[model samples]
Target: MSSVSTRASFTAPALALVINAFVWGTSWWPFRQLEARGLHPLWATVLIYAVAVLVILALRPRALGQLLRTPVLWILVLASGTTNAAFNWAVTLGDVVRVVLLFYLMPLWAVLLARLVLREPLTHHAAARVLLALAGAAVVLWPAGRSGWEALPLPRTLPDWLGVLGGFCFALNNVMLRREAHRPEEARALAMFVGGMAVAGTLALVLVGNGMASPPPAPAPGWVAGVAAMALLFLAGNLALQYGAARLPANVTSVVMLTEILFASISALALGGGHLDGQLLGGGALILAAALLSTLSGADAH
Candidate 1:
């Protein structure tokens, strides 16, 4: 009887993480669809997160006060906000697989950030993982039919840059979550939700003001429905993430979250939003290998 209860407790959190992964993995399709309907991804992020924020506030109004009073949570707000804004925009404008692969570089950034923020020692194993991940990134960024400095493995497109940026911020967000795990869960959730809305909303307004991007089209059933659905989905996913991440070791959380890559890859390929090739497969394998190693090492460390 005790064993059964223990297993249930363990399984529930792991499954919750999987739920979060699935929501994000398939989110690109909806973002793209909304974009087609004249809703920019930034604007869509604002609306989706706005709904989520309202729901959270309705249920736990004190979360807003907690987030505001806790100075450390402000870091979480910026990190989570930047992660969603950058990733959503990048995935919408870039090859889904490539963008995802780039974003999954989170592990590399995680290793570094954990060391810096958590004061985790930079062990030899961690260093090796970093090198492996860097090699994988180079392979992924390697250009075809180019040579010398011109072919340097660097981000050449806007989507590529955004992917890298999002990955870094996501790493920071995860580290901050672990750091502040003792905080009230609702406060953390509120911070993340608010970040998404604030960052995306500010960017959208800036772009619209400068005529760099079109404003959100007048409300229509198509985008309205999409935004509403996404709001609920993201809210659920965020809550699951908070619950699961808080309960599990960060390394274990990372391993489970890798399913996001598989989900994104399959969905994008099936829907024609992405393609596969030798270079990508090879590089992706290397990157994932490094990430797996990093997680295992982190678990062992703890």
Candidate 2:
């Protein structure tokens, strides 16, 4: 009976992981469409997340109450917010492969943050994986064959930095999530979704304040339709991710996150007018391998 129940418990999380993959895999299309229609990614991010937060509030009012009672939840909000904003903005403006590879650097950041924040002592194997990940990133970001040390090698574009920053923020988010694993899953889910809105709104305000874009338009009728659809998708994705991550071990969950890159890459290739480039594919493979190995290493050590 215990064996049967254990197996049964895994089903929901496995299904949730699949749904989360599909949502992220196909997300680039809607982002592009919204961008073409003159709603920039940042605008769409704020619109979608705000609506999702409202949905969460309506469905689980208690989640907000939980958040209010705990200061740690607010920290999660900040971490999650920065992560979502950085990812949304980076993917919109950069090469899908390049951005995704950079974002996978989360494992390196995760390991370091885990050591400091969670006090999970880093093993030598983990340290090696981090170095390999960094080397892989350097190879990709190194300007087309200008590998000399004096080149001050860096990602030569704004989107590259955003992608890396997003990954770092995601690492912080994951660390906080792990540290606060004792919290109710509902509260964590609320923090993830609401924190995303907070980040997007703050960034949008900064951009507008600095004259980065024109003022937003007054609400429109179709805007309602768009926001509704966007919110539903965002809420579904967030819930699926939370559900899946909660059921799986940390290493398994980390491995599952790799699906986003696959989904993003394949969708970008098929529908987002992206092409597979050798430098990107090579770099991406290394980064993904490092992330997988890091998790596997930890699991093996245990």
Estimate, for each residue in 70-186, the C-alpha lDDT of model 1 and write its tens digit: 999999989999999999999899999999999988778888998889998888888888888899899999999998887999999999999999999998998898799899989
TM-score of 2: 0.89
Q: Deviation in angstroms for 1 in model 2? A: 12
- CA lDDT, every model vs. true structure: 0.90, 0.77
Regions of model 2 farther than 4 Å from truth: 1-12, 145-150, 220-223, 298-302
Model 2: per-residue lDDT, tens digit, 175-222?
787678899877887898788888888788888899886455666655
What value of lDDT does candidate 2 attain over all alpha carbons? 0.77
Clash pairs, model 1 backbone: none
What TM-score, computed on C-alpha atoms, does each candidate reach?
0.94, 0.89
lDDT of 2 at 19: 82
Off by over 4 Å in 1: 1-10, 246-249, 299-302
Distance from true position, residue 193, model 2, in Å? Answer: 1.9
